[model samples]
Target: MKATLILVGTELLSGGMIDTNSLYMAEELNKYGIEIGSKITVKDKIEDIINAITYGKENSDLIIMSGGLGPTIDDITKEAIAKYLNKKLVVDQDELNELKEKFRERNLKFIEINTKEVEKPEGSVTFKNGAGMAPAVYIDGIVCFPGVPIELYDMFPKFLKWYSEEKKLKSDEILIKDLITYGIAESLLDNKISDIFTEEGIDYEFLVKDFGIIIRLQSKISNKNIVEKIVEKIYNRVGDNIFGEDSDRLEKLIIKSLKEKGKTLSVAESCTGGLLSDSFVNVSGASEVFMEGIVTYSNDAKIKRLGVKKETLEKFGAVSEETAREMVLGLKTDVGISVTGIAGPLGGTKEKPVGLVYMGIRNGNEVEVEKKVFKGSRRKVRERAVLHSLFCLNKMLKRK
Candidate 1:
């Protein structure tokens, strides 16, 4: 099956707001073996929306639209869809009552303007919005969702369930898996698995994320063994670089590995601030393995808190391997990780440059420090440093 997505919002066109709903919808549809042929983004203008709808109706089997479904005057998606489909706008009494009840439960006044949320095209199937007041509308093959992400997320499942039961869409049994890897460049990875990617009935997508690179493998064949064999072939070629699959996060994996081994970790940060610590702490049950995290940004703080000598700071500066090693050594844990870097638009010397980072990991009596120069803005540099530190820590833990 083929689908087209129309995202309607002036804010999205003006770069004031990002359109992430289309991505979610595309992924969801692809899971059902539906291919997205086109994605259109239009302003809140009714004319533009109508044009997009006309185009979608002519070219696509299923049209999904998101945005401009609100109480505000600029919310014209329902009107545009009604005009395109030659259907009259009618107020859904049940939806209107639900909206009114929601407002009354929250002790908020329900003005007449709020009634717009319950208005739908004639003969359209309306889905309840669990997250907000705006109801989702489906007419013919077209589906409309609220601009709000939370509302769309909540309503989409119900819509999908209804469509599945009503249409009885056959599943193609398409399967997609994301194999996440770090500490390797995309070029090298592609070169290593270049031959395997060309195999029939399979597709590959290489996405560079903030944490690492993700290799998405999709299998058209329904057989589980065939998919596993294809995955095992890719694994045999580049298994060492693969960390986890699908939604597995590097920090969560590290925490899980540490907990499994009954090990604890401590961290000291300089240029990355508390980002590394924040990543680790975001995982549930991290307190079982995470002992402490210290952000020693200043030389005095490094000396006082992490036991870095004043002489070491004077000779090697804060963004040095020596300083990173000392910072890690200061913390007492089964594993100690430290990051020191120059993530800067300024504060770079002739010898030391911006994006220069030093990460140190102390495991038992063994200590390892790696120096790298990343390229990006200050925020990007710090993020890369933190991710690299986690990658190093993961490797060290795996070795132990």
Candidate 2:
């Protein structure tokens, strides 16, 4: 099966809001072996919506649209869809009554404008939105969803189930595996594993993302044995640089490893602020292994909070390896990590340029500090610093 995605919103074009719905939709559809042929973003105007739908219908078997489903006047997705399909709009009384009951349950007044939320194209199938006011409607091979990300996420599973049954889709045709790797350049990674792409019935692509490089291997035949052989070859070539597989996060893996090994960790941050700590805490069950974290943004905080000596800051500055080592050593845990960097468009000197980072990892009596220089904006530098810290920590954890 093939699909086309339409994202309709003036805010998306004007940079007022990001369009995240399409990515989620594409990934979910791909799980069912539905190929996304194209994705179009258009303004909230009816003409643009109709044109996009026309293109979708011409090129793909399924058309999925999101946005402009609110009660406001500018919300015209359903109107354009009805116009394109030559259908009349009608109010679904059951949906309207349910929406009103929901509003009343929350002790909120039901405004007259909200009635527009239940108006679907005549003879179309409608699915109630469990997370929001608008209902998703399917008409003439197109599915309409509210632009709000949470609502689309909540309602996508129901749509997917209905769609698979209606189309009698077999999901075992295409299979994809994603290998996430860090601490290696894309060109170097390609040099190591590029030869394996010549195997029959398999396709490959490399994606350069902010965090790392993703090696996506797809098999058209869905032969598990061939896919596993190719994966084994790639692993043999790439080795430890391949940190995790599909949907595996480095922070979450670190937390899980710590729990398995019966270890606790703490962190101190400088230019990275609290981002490193935030990543660890975002994982569930982190409390079992995460002991404490402190953001010593100032020299005084480093000296007072983490017990760094005044002399060390004066001699080597706060962004030096000496300061990072002291910061990690001061923390009382089975493992301690520290990051200090100069992430800047300013506050850079000849000796300490922007993106110069020092990361320290201390496990037991052993400690190591690494100096790295990265390139990008301030946020990029800070994010890279955090990723580097996690990579180094992972290496330490693998040690005997």
Candidate 3:
């Protein structure tokens, strides 16, 4: 089955709010083998909402609309859906009584405008809202949800249960696996696994995340063995670039690797502040391998805290390979990583433009420092530097 998602909110259209509801709905629908045909975001205008509904009705088997269900006059989702379906908007007396009882329970008086929450399109199946006042509406393959995330979350399961039973959908499960890869570009990874993507009965989706590229393989085929073989083929083709899969994060993997090798890690960070160390500490059980982390933002701090020499900072500057190496060597640990960079919209010299980063990783006596010039905003530069440091640490641990 195919579905269309419509997000209705002036705030979403005006960039004041993010539409996370669509992401949740898409994931849930995909789990039931329902393919998303289109996703539309429209402002709170009545005409636009009706047009979106009409478009979705023509193109999809199921249309799910979220947002604009409230007591306010601007919340016109129910009215617009009623107009589109050519149905009367009538007050559901039972739902109205429920709303009044809920307000009474909270020691608040229910106003006349609160009746909007109980109004539904004529002949629609109304699901009681356990989380909020507005009832969820479903009619003629269209499901309407309130804009509130908590209410939607509480009501979605009931809708899903109804949908499964009404449609008599087959029990064949949709299996999805995310193969997380780093240190590789999307185009290169796609080219390497082009053959596996073309194999029958499987679908592939490549998503670029902050850490790296996530190659998602989804199959509805009943046989699980075939899917495993396909995943194994991709793994063999990609090799070490594929670090972990599904919810396996890079920091978690790094911490796990360090623990397995019985090694300790310390960091001396400059331009990235304590971001590299923060990533390491984000993983649970990080205290088992993480030793210490210090952020020496200024030359004085570098000298006082990490023991970076004045001569190295003067000659090679703070954003240089020599400074990074000195910082790493200053930290006393089995594994030492240092990052010094010029992440800035300002304060960049002609010789050292913005995003000039030097990362140093030392395991035992062998130390490797890499000089890279990335191009992006200050936050992007810092984020990229942190990932690069973690990737370098992963390589060092693998070598041991």
Number of the top candidate by TM-score?
Answer: 2
Tens-digit lDDT track of model 3 for 113-202: 999988889999988899988989999999999988999999988898888989987536788888888888899998999777666788
**Where does candidate 3 have its weakest 10-residue lDDT segment?**
169-178
Give candidate 3 regions above 4 Å deviation: 14-20, 83-140, 146-162, 165-172, 259-266, 281-293, 332-336, 362-366
lDDT of 1 at 143: 93
Order of all candidates by lDDT, from best down to worst?
A: 2, 3, 1
Candidate 2: Cα lDDT at 356:
97
Every model's TM-score: 0.93, 0.96, 0.81
Q: Each model's number of backbone clashes?
A: 0, 0, 0
Per-residue lDDT of candidate 1, residues 259-307 (tens digit): 9999889999999989989999999999999998999999999999989
Model 1 regions lying over 4 Å from their true place: 104-107, 170-172, 221-223
Question: In model 3, what lDDT does residue 281 have?
Answer: 86
Predicted candidate 2 versus true structure: per-residue lDDT over 1-400, tens digit per residue: 7899999999999999988788788778877888899999999899999999999999999999999888899999999999999999899788999999989988989999988888888999988798988989998799999999999998988998888888888666678899999998999999999988887777799988766799998876557788888899989999789888998888988898888889899999999999999989999989999998999999999999999999999999999999999999989999989999999979888999999999999877889998999899999999999998898888888893
Ranking by TM-score: 2, 1, 3
Assess candidate 3 and give its TM-score to the true structure. Answer: 0.81
lDDT of 2: 0.90
Error of 2 at 143 (Å): 0.3
Clashing pairs in 3: none
